[model samples]
Target: MDLSGENFRIMILYDFKSNLTVQKSFVRLRTAFEDEAPCKTAICNCFAEYKSGRINLSNEFRDGRPSTAVNIDGVRRMIETDRHVTYHEIQTSLGIGMN
Candidate 1:
């Protein structure tokens, strides 16, 4: 099963409070999740960041490319060009994946 947001936060907190080495923490977390925990690399990275005070248990907003698929002008132009245009057609013509 996928870890819920609450469980992920709890895992972070557990890592912090337990003060276990990354490997040990990963093993414990894996056991907690019935061997379906997140990858070791991800767990280690997050633990390192958290120990270094770079991140907290709360979710942070990540900066990345803003979405362009929902452009108003593009949608308006598509509608003007064809009232009965299917969403698939718009996606294909605009080369935008469903987000």
Candidate 2:
């Protein structure tokens, strides 16, 4: 079964309500989701962040490079530079993978 976004919220709620330790939460989630469970490290880190008041039920922005490949100007510039460029060439030049 694929994990739904709501599952994360549920897990976090479970953690909060039960005050389960990270390892216990990990095991609980593993059993709850079976093979579809998220990685143990991710659960541990998320719980740690929650306990530290670093994140809430929702995701928060942190430090990271802003996505640039989808910018209209960037795409326009790439096309203007080489109208004959293949998709592979554009991906290589822009350092962005296609969806």
Candidate 3:
């Protein structure tokens, strides 16, 4: 496989083993793609963060307004959507609001 593919595979394994929190995972993703251009890095980080379950990407908004102070909408949405979902589920979901 090419270097890029090999790197991604390594990242996936590392991500799975680390069991890192959303913020930490996001930081790692940023570091991973730091060499890329700004726009590419931002997109990569956003997608990576989502895939790592460190953040939530849902349609539900908080109180019909975006919370500018703290970002918990992702957790709130996940909890509301399925209260039975475990803490790990929230952690593994594609959103970062989980605690």
Best by lDDT: 1
> Whole-model lDDT for model 3 versus the true structure?
0.52
CA deviation > 4 Å runs, candidate 3: 1-3, 35-99
Q: Where does candidate 1 stray beyond 4 Å? A: 60-99
lDDT of 1 by residue, 1-99 (tens): 676654675676678668877788778877878656767776777776677676555545422465454666897899998999998988888776776
Tens digits of per-residue lDDT for model 2 on 1-99?
Answer: 676645675676578668888778778887888777767777776776667776555445542365554556776788898898788877787677776
Error of 2 at 69 (Å): 4.8
lDDT of candidate 3 over 15-91, digit per residue (tens): 54566654555466557565431243433554465565654333243122355443478778888999898977776
In model 2, what is the error at residue 2, expressed in angstroms?
A: 3.1
Q: Of the pair 1 and 2, which is ahead by lDDT?
A: 1
Per-model TM-score on C-alpha atoms: 0.50, 0.51, 0.27
Model 2 residue 72 lDDT score: 61
Better model by TM-score, 1 or 3? Answer: 1
lDDT of 1 at 14: 79
lDDT score of model 2? 0.70
